[model samples]
Target: MNQRNSTQLHPPTRHFSVLLSPTPRGARLARLLATEWLRTWELPHHATEAAEHLVAELAANAATHGRLPGRDFRLALLAGSETLRVEVTDTRGDDLPHRRPATPDGESGRGLLLVEALSDRWGVELGPVPRKTVWAELDLSPEFGNVCSGGSGALLQETREGKKPHQAPPLPPTEPAHSRE
Candidate 1:
């Protein structure tokens, strides 16, 4: 008699993406959606909170600095066994983000500072004509192991099933904000 051992292979990456209008309301919605998704994935509490802040900051920057009339921005979350990456892509390819010291009296300009402090790694990627992506990564704690073992698609399905009462509605598809030069 021969016996075969069983093993299951899981994809190493899980991803979620959405497009939203470049508005303050859109940015707020991005943060809330990210928070809900992270919670659905069952990530560590600290990681979830930090990722929420990162999403808020990056989304706000896209809405404030990278906004183009009639254009929408995209928010994406990619989770691996060891890292979770948050990215916000906008149509403003020429407007690159920079880190600057905030004055004590200034009311704003501290978003990137908070991102730098909270994320394990963060950077801006400019390319593919008329678009730029600002991304931040949080290192997953070993204690949590693989938070997305079941894959993000399943978690998204669960979110859509009204697991939470306050889950945001899905965003509609958007057209290109501007033509390629």
Candidate 2:
């Protein structure tokens, strides 16, 4: 027999969730899975690409800075009419993330900075016990395509011109949109 729920009668709200071990491999998996799910949801290339890196950065932080001896992290993706939210919850509630200035010559510590540049808005949420969620949201409105047409390229250009990211202008539509992941 066929069974149907209320949401099944209409367009189901898009969401994906998973728990993964707190390890480097797990962080990599989180990015891969989110990318595929975003594609399945039919998001435009820009949203999918931004979300993929957002998930990667959050998951990497969870695995690197939030790992507990035996606990895993949770990854969740929720898509609304005009936004996609990515959340990575780890066991280190005491270790809230703060955005530090990006170093021009450093090898690491740029994850959160990238997250801020890519996401429309992002912040940390402390919770029930032994857990904290680092979340970022990307705009998926009609303007998304035009807004991020240059993606990381524009950010790089700003740096080369000695302009801080905040001092730079919105990315111009210099390239046709395409999926990078």
Candidate 3:
């Protein structure tokens, strides 16, 4: 069972949340969905890509380390004028994520290190009961303020009304068009 919701805290803040099964597929889906949403919001290319990676690592950790039978993990994205935050919550409060030195020959145990490197700041938060949310934040560049031409309120309204929010302008064709002879 998957659930999704969107919220507008204020004129400059936007939020999106979804609940997904705690599985490898779910973690992959979280990354894909987050990438699409970030692009829809017209965030800068670098920031969007960075956030995508952050979501992937955090969601993977939740699915792998925080798994509980019949429990779903939650992925939440908060976009503000100056920052973008990615969070993944699971039903394992006692199992908190920590950074450790990864062995050179080990294939695993490097997700948190990647998270720390890619995010401006990252941490874990314990919830009401039997839940924990791991979050990472990226500081947006000044030009990010100019990406949303329609304004955050308008975008939120479109989302609430079930209309597709404005998308970034399409990229130019790689080759120039030829003139008719």
Q: Which candidate is the best by TM-score?
A: 1
Model 1 clash count equals 0
Query: After superposing candidate 3, which stretches have Cα over 4 Å from the reference?
Result: 1-10, 142-181
Runs in model 2 lying further than 4 Å from the true structure: 1-11, 100-103, 144-146, 149-181
- Give me candidate 1's TM-score against the actual structure: 0.73
The lDDT leader among the candidates is 2
Query: Residue 146 lDDT in model 2?
Result: 41
Alpha carbon deviation, residue 115, candidate 1 (Å):
0.9
Measured with C-alpha atoms, the lDDT of residue 38 in candidate 1 is: 90
Q: Poorest 10 consecutive residues of model 1 by lDDT?
A: 172-181
Q: Candidate 3 has which clashing residue pairs, if any? A: none
* Overall lDDT per candidate, in order of appearance: 0.73, 0.74, 0.73
Root-mean-square deviation (CA) per prediction: 13.4, 10.7, 16.7
lDDT of 2 by residue, 106-128 (tens): 86688866876677666666787
TM for candidate 3 is: 0.71
TM-score of each: 0.73, 0.73, 0.71
Ranked candidates, highest TM-score first = 1, 2, 3
As for lDDT, the candidate ahead, 2 or 3, is 2
Give the C-alpha miss distance for residue 30 in model 3, angstroms: 0.4
Better of 1 and 2 by lDDT: 2
